[model samples]
Target: MQSTPSYLWSTEDLLGQGATASVYKARNKKSGELVAVKVFNNASYLRPQEVQMREFEMLRKLNHKNIVKLFAVEETGSSKQKVLVMEYCSSGSLLNVLEEPANAFGLAESEFLIVLQCVVAGMNHLRENGVVHRDIKPGNIMRLVGEDGRSIYKLTDFGAARELEDDEKFVSVYGTEEYLHPDVYERAVLRKPQQKAFGVTVDLWSIGVTFYHAATGSLPFVPFGGPRRNKEIMYKITTEKPPGAIAGIQRQENGSIEWSYELPITCRLSAGLKDQLIPILANILEVDQEKCWGFDQFFAGTNDILHRIVVDVFSLQQASSHRIYIHSYNTTTMFLDAVFKQTNIVPHHQEYFFEGHLYELDPNLQARHFCRTTESSPLTLLSTSEQPEDVVGVQYRDPALDFPKLVPRVDVVADCSAAKSAVGAAHQTLRVGQALRRGRELLARGLHWVIGNLRTECSRILEQRRGAHSVLACLQLTEGRTHVLCEAVPAGGRAPAGLDVLRTRLRRVDEELSQCSRSIFDFQGALDGILAELAKDGQQVHEDKSIQQIECCLEKMQVIYKQFKRARTCLRLGYNEEQIHKLDKLNLGSLARRVLSIFQNGCVQQYQEALALHSSRMRKVCEIKKHLKRLSNRISSCSVEMMECQDCLQGALDRLLQTENWDLAAAPPAPSPVPLSQARQEMVLGMQELLEQMRSVTCDLQLNNSIIERLGGAAPTPSV
Candidate 1:
């Protein structure tokens, strides 16, 4: 190791020993820069030169702010003493910070947010660059003091880091044993060593597990069994729960206690924070890796969380003076319920009486916000009838308006097998007939409203253009060009007043084009919002087809619109002689060629653009109409199933009610056997199959299916 001269920069003393190297604080002699140097321990049989070269190559390419910087690499004369120069983090590792507080790292919520954001962002950057920090734990994260005096987090140690595409055979096991994901250990323990085909998602799982530990100060899952307990944990990670489990203390209303693996990791967060976190967390920890949120989501989520923090802080001070008013739509039920139960309405919507002066707004306001429906309702019903509107636009109070309510039904069908046939018979005989009648009537009314709205806008634009054109024609006849030219003979020259008339017509066209563009933009925004909602559902055949058709149409429309935009830009610069000659032959007076060209081009472009956009949008509507054909077929099948389930439910309800009313003490403890309806069961099975097929489609296609919206409605039960 002494043959090659060591580029040693000895300044600060040696710090401590790591698992594989000796760390020292040092400053460069020439540059006067502070850095940390890691000298690897002697390798008995392993090739130190090859290992250090690979590690240095990977380290030099990483440029994330949250990742430690590798300054330089040096090898001793013996070719065994390899030293890596790295950025020095003065604050030290997070493991050191956690050791300070016994109560599971008692970090303030704000500090926790900062740490979490930094770590996720750094890891996300690495993943994007095709690298995975296979070993990510508290010990490997280094914290440094920034200019703002805030602790900055950085991920270190690239010795175990592997290129995402590397397929080399596995050798020595890497990473801390306790923190290893099950898959990692499995690959290491294989009889014939094989390179694991892990993706970027694996790094994310480790980050999630790390955050869970950071928040609660413990691992969510504890492996129970012996020597290879870590392996057992890994098994649980893959086979037991594809998604990471959340740990928390939960209490049942009946005083029974049980452990829940599905607890949201953010359950400890306040209501405001939890509300903001749920969706983002769901995206980050999805079962399907494709749907998982990457670095982009982390930044967006961080901004949202920070905004919420500000609002939360402000709300605390005005908690007493600023009151939250809860209003009900109907007082009749509430009054009656209060008389019997000593409370107003359901617990979730029970009105809170505040000290501040409260005012009631008009009733029957249009519902604009999209909110989740209650547990009892499958559809998110809109209450736009403007009655009993509180300070908020809409009232989402339950109709029950009763307190101390009766027992909620735990099951809809008791004897699933027997109930199916009876339900099918009743549905086909009565329910299907009724639903068909109702659906036809609803479709007719919706069609009328849509057609009327489009016709009115089209008529208005046509009238404006007609009137503008007539005015321009009348000017030419009244003020002949020669007479106008004589009048325009300034002290030295003459021009016709007819030029003014042409200018006026041009200006009018410009105004009309502006209004049309704004109208189209508004329409597009509405469409975008609707599509966003549809994206959340993975199933729904009709929506998938409709969304796909609309996207293709939109892309084509955008191309045509771009061409029109370019033509308009050129016209605004001034019309050439060729365009002027064409207009002159049409007998139109010259009135600022540049302005005239713009008006003429815009007139043509606006109509073309609008037509393209409208035609594309109409194509979407047509495609959706086609999907309705499939939906109709599915609905017919659903009707058969719905009846079967209804019969099963009613029978179960009858038996329970009879037992309660008759007080039959000698009755059998077990309820009578109720079987599922075969026809209804088959119908239900069909809906599940359709839903699964929809899931196989791409994200863009799935959005059109409106699965998210359907889920909240009485959509059929999807197959697992």
Candidate 2:
């Protein structure tokens, strides 16, 4: 038997067989490298010659790290039993790992990262290489566990992939049912009558499903009938919004998952790691492919996210971990210095009383306590500093990673004297007077600390100056730093220098500092405006509450008036003049009883009304969501139809080009108006026509996307 050099593999030991193909562990006798041999079923291969050609062509072009390498093809046997030889991985598949997540998983983040890296690497590589791995699932991803028990993943099985040679065109009905994109699937089957054409983005839809399984060890969108029944499920997953990225955070009281028993490594992990994964996963699982990263972009983003996780959570604490925590009400001006010191990631902040003092930071910095405030929920900020792990009375510094955590929000309020008094008071009334005073005191102290730090640093810089040039340079540098300091301090706090001289000299050093100080004046004006607006709003709420109280009083008065009229009526009737006169002379006690009765009735009615109104609003929101789902289905269908039409046109053009190139090579040196001249002319004309058609089609597709995006109520289309 004769074999070619490319024949690095031959099937020997059978690994397993699926419905479509049988996989075998094999070795190249020549190179002596172990490999996996996948033999396509005769039915799927020989049924149509084009199918085999397409599969072979796709596999040949794809060469990537995460994707399983296709080494060779054997075409020797008379029966023509075709085989695809790929790089063999020791571990079998992701399905088995998921089946026993709690038992076999080494570390959750590590496991997730492997799965994330490999799947994304392969998918992205494929997309970049002009292919879409339509079938993306755990079974297709093979893993190998290392000595450290970490899983390394490799994406396999591109049999279902479609070659999307053009980015603008769409290919229809080309993925596994369970993993099929809703828009593409809808278009393939014509769910919507009017919708046309879908695009290369369908691969991202499948990736969303893949990510869901990777994170929670459960499918976000499961099909009852298995992969084949995923058509309808995909529609729901893609068309309807899944919970927002922070939905889990909202559902929990403390924004922490309640685990029955903590996992070994997870218990030691940072809170940032826990919170960060949710948002990253949420972005990956976005239904809109445009919002999700393309293969290259996804990997780049993955690297950044992974690097942050390692620096902030896994690696030893260093200079990078000394983060500045800000309050939600904090201005951008306040953190201008911090932002200038590092790459600007808006510092997270919250409005909270930490250690009996109220402070505000920008909400972006406050991971644990953003968008949370209620009677039951008091606030605190997570401080990041170089403080020792065993700092006296500190509840939160980590020895392993060396980070600090704020005392929980609930504790902040409970530990306060005012809070304890409020609860103990007979009237159950909250007195903010003491808490306000304490918060003011802290603000003053923090301001003084900022000014002192600025003064000390400035004095040292100026003192070291020896020459004319050095002094000028020192003054300029000091001015910039000082301006940043002043902005960070609260209102009415003095800057490092007096305003008049500082403004004139500072303007010469850096326009930004000068501009920022001016901006402060603008901010102060804005603050005044906000205060005025708040005063108006406060009056409105007060007036409404007062009106409600007055209405209650008037209602009681009505009952009294009615009783008085009845007494008068009885007196006029002359049936019981003595009794009527006695009733008319009613005392405070009797009048109070009647008034209380009316007031209680009104209060009950108000409660019932409020409940009814809440229920009505909830129902309306649900109804709107349902309509949006149906509209989404319609839009997806349209998208698919449009995609299919575009694909057909693109495919036709590709065929024409392929044929034209063949003709150009085969034809003898052509003369004008020769035998093949007309044919060649026709092909060129067809190519030109196809190009124009593709352009128009692409325009239409973009318009449809904009419409869908607008209807979905998302932010306006971001730069692709």
Candidate 3:
């Protein structure tokens, strides 16, 4: 380095602090630029000579956008201690973002993908350089916003990183306790007698844990009192065969372990994304080294997800919507092609509107333009068998890569009374026409939004309604079987050994079914009430009606503008310093502003009222949708649990039927209870019915998204 990076700012202005080092935000005096100075404490320096120098050497050698840039090594002015000057990340760490209350359920799907992409890229770089990041966690990953205003993540804190080949092993344990591999935890934290060496796969285990935490906003494995308090259980839970991305624990010390094969219901990642992610996690977080995916495979899997574009799209012709995944960069043409493949609708026959603006097929038209993330409203695709003519709509798309060279103090579309020339007046008229057309389309959209919702909700309700009846029928059949078993057991005689388990499972089924029924009924009631309220306040307004109203208001404003122009011409005929100035300022400009305001007020009264009503409905719809979603999740989970119950019940029923009094084994075996056998048959069939019905009742929300490619001249809307 020509000149050493300086720590001119106060050390007290800290950016982050860790166990071994304190990072401060400092300004480099040599170049007058901001940088992060990592000053190690004496404790960090006391490590083995190689260990102390390894981090700096590795960081210096590694060069990637995802890896923190090493500027220069310098010394503190006060103590003359060695320190590091690295790239400054003003956005802080990934941990800070995760800690926000809003992200309690983990990052939104898009942000999670970004983190996944950056971390994978960064790790791939490290692997290429033969480096192992022994301690990988969210806190160690720094976040910085790029010039494009999107987050760029960099791997930092190389204190525990070292060069390691694929087969190389080091018999040392170093990692956060929560993220430590079972073998490492046993040797280092457990202090057990062992001679197992750690390899590159240990980093995979850590990465798995980090990814889990990032995806779920919590660690994968935690016992009653954390990893430290119940070390053996945590180790056992992790090392157990048939692992999943999520970890569960037994309630009691002596109880059998409980494991979940899926992420929590509260996790914000979409089902489609989660389906792709869980497999990668399963490959990476394996307890058995032989089964874990190597770096190459890991890179391939993550890059696959990153490279594929997934978004929801809504088709009006089909009166339905679904998610689409594009393997190429998401451009408007690419989007239309993707839709064509999925829906068999030709691109030429399709008309697309995003956020009420028509999407014109120009070079600038991209995915960002059509970014409706919510299931309730997706990117609108108007699919007709025949192509339409003269599609008049606003198609100006903004960009993120650069700003337009706009003229100062200039407006694109001058309002009435503001046009000073014929060309300007023509442009203003065209603008008014566009605005009226947009308004008309908005009205159409509002109407379609409500009708589409009614169609979707009614369909869902019908499915759930049928499911409820099936469950009730199953419940009735189950009750009948249990009654038969009750009849078989004498009034005070001891029941069969397996009878208790059978009863317990039946009780669980009963409770879950009741919960599902209540949720569905409540959802139905809310939907009915909202629809009725809307129906009462609603009236059909033709698109042309609003356009006519606006057009008439514009005509009145144009008349005023002509009269003002004539008056201005008369005033100019007498052209004087005092008279012209007064006429232009007090009369012309003030009257124009007042008339335009009046004109706006007159035309938008109906529009504003309808907008307010729609906004209110949307908010109510949002809340109800959340409730419905929660209910849907519960029903789906209940269905899975019921299937498990059916399995357990089948085993118990088998044992119950096969039971015999062993004391009388020498004698002929007692006759099998015919009533009990009949009961078993009924219960098994009924349980299957119950599960099938519950599965059928699950909420199915579909969305169709065709986003304008990134800054595709428009930004994608973030989902709530």
Candidate 4:
């Protein structure tokens, strides 16, 4: 019922509420963008202010697709309560998704993998930034419906996050009790000195638990009852294996346990997927933090299921290539069925060859095994009449080996215009597809660079500001010492009037220095807000114009950075002068320049490093553009060649069809000396090849469009 922050307009809807804060659906008055405003009650004291500050700092630094974006922070009311304005995730939290009755049975393996991948990516970014997200439960992972209509999982609620130092141990008891690492819980209860310091591995363990819940629709370890539930759960987490290893206990009528043993079925894991997932889960749930699987290990273990296998198919006679996506577990027959669906080739008349051997139609063997054995060798499809030896013989021969040989040419009737038009349309589609893909990649790379530069800049500024603050504190202490000296001096016998005047000037400069430091801190917050806006704009960059808009935003940020640098430089100089004056009084003037030089050198190094990273990213963007142009030209050439092949085949088919009739009694004279059966078979093969090429083109276009959409761009209209 309380009025929201002045900058935000609260809607009638309350998104959700927690014990410490209540979230409301609100809009940024200035930008007119819908957002969630999480207002924390000042009086509750449930969550400490420092915790909220830590969360704000972490969110401000992170600019990843899989992290909740913090737009702005506002303080209002007589109590000066704090409110966090954040991106509104329409789909709510993953916890809500899992709790839905329709999803109660747990998400499908594919869906679960998508969620897990996003979470891992976000966590990896956090780890790289020296941040440890101690809390990584399902409730903290939100699902946002992306522009492509796919669910994007993001990590939220970073109240328990802390910047980790390599040697410093994290001993504080934080995060949800259920998700807490056993070592952390043990240290809290027993105060054991032997407990090893937990690190990023603790987060991996929490993710493992979350993965188990998402996979099974039940927590692997659950809290049941009594005052000792925490201890019981911690004991289970430390000593027990995953629930997948435990079988149900058989109890007598009196409720005494009769027997218990290992059972795989208890976890509802299909036999085929069990081998792929069990190792990952085991590594994640390992009690020793040192042994726990990190993001890379987890990804490697489930890489096959998590990603699609790319299969390339080449038609022998048509000289056409097609790429297809297939699950690793799909059987050879299943893959063939998919290929036939695209090529429209009859299985009886077609022979698929890979790695110098014909493909066997064994339903029991998995496609993964074939790919592994063949090492992803290209597959060639030949007509039933063709022999592998003949193909080999053709490959071995070179036209230059012999003198220019004359070959007889066959002229046949065909619709050349239709073929030309199709090729032109396909060529245009390829051009558009290439541009979209390049643009998406450029934008992604540019954003990454921008974020990296921004983070580095902000960190440098923050560091400078910290230094300014220290100088100001030292100045105050020096002033206190000067006051003591002035008080101790007996009635102006030796105390100079210049010393009093200098003291007064020093106090005035300190006040100005304090104001400048405050301004720097405020600017940092403002920069965070702008960066969040830029992130949103980057997502919706559908056209060149939108891209220009983002460029303008980045330019504005650069201008702001320049101004911040200038202000910090002025404050630093002021601080240096004040320190020099104090040092002169202490007869240490020689060391003043030395100390200032060290600070200046540090700043210079940071600036140089940022510039180097920016230049590297720009070079990458240029390289990607050049590569895209080359790819576009190649696609155009391929389309032209394909069109010519289609034209020749059409002509041959027309000549052959004219000579043959459906009714044998009304058959006409042959237009050419070609046999009817051979002509018919050749025509079928040609048409199948043509169809496969067209399908591949269509698939490529659709894929490009999807990629553009995922990059927050609009898909171009298809030409055909």
Q: Please identify which of the two predictions, 2 or 4, would achieve the higher TM-score against the true structure.
A: 4
What TM-score, to 2 decimals, does candidate 2 have?
0.39
Return the TM-score for each candidate structure: 0.39, 0.39, 0.49, 0.41
Question: Who is ahead in TM-score, 1 or 2?
Answer: 2
TM-score of 1: 0.39
Clashes per candidate (backbone, < 3 Å):
40, 26, 14, 0
Q: Write the per-residue lDDT of candidate 4 for residues 249-331, one digit (tens) a residue.
A: 21222232222221123232333344456567667776776767665676666565557564666544333334455687887
User: Which segments of model 4 are wrong by more than 4 Å?
Assistant: 1-12, 30-32, 43-50, 165-168, 187-196, 223-234, 242-272, 302-305, 308-720
For model 2, the superposed segments whose C-alpha errors exceed 4 Å read 1-13, 30-32, 76-78, 101-107, 145-150, 185-196, 223-234, 242-271, 288-297, 309-720
Arrange candidates by TM-score, descending: 3, 4, 2, 1
The deviation in Å at residue 321 for candidate 1 is 15
Best by TM-score: 3
**What's the lDDT for candidate 3?**
0.61
Q: Write the per-residue lDDT of candidate 1 for residues 1-720, one digit (tens) a residue.
A: 122143454424665565677777776656666778877776522655666576788888888899999877876555556678899998778776654322232243456667777787787677667777778887788899889988899998877776673222244556765455445556654333556555555555566556655554545444443225445433444334434334322132222222334423322233334445445544454434555555466557755564331211101000111111112333424322321231112322322111121112223421222122221111111111222212111111211121112122211222111122222222222222222222222222222233333333334433333332343233223224323323333232443333344445434544544454454445445445434433332122122232233233333333333333344444343446335433332221121222223322432233234334333443443343333333333432333332333233223323433533422233322443775456534533433332333233222222322332332212443322
- Candidate 3, residues 362-481, lDDT tens digits: the string is 534666554545544456666535332222222221111111122222222331124233222222333333433444344346434544454455356435434534543453454445
The local distance difference test score of model 4 is: 0.51
lDDT per model, in order? 0.42, 0.45, 0.61, 0.51
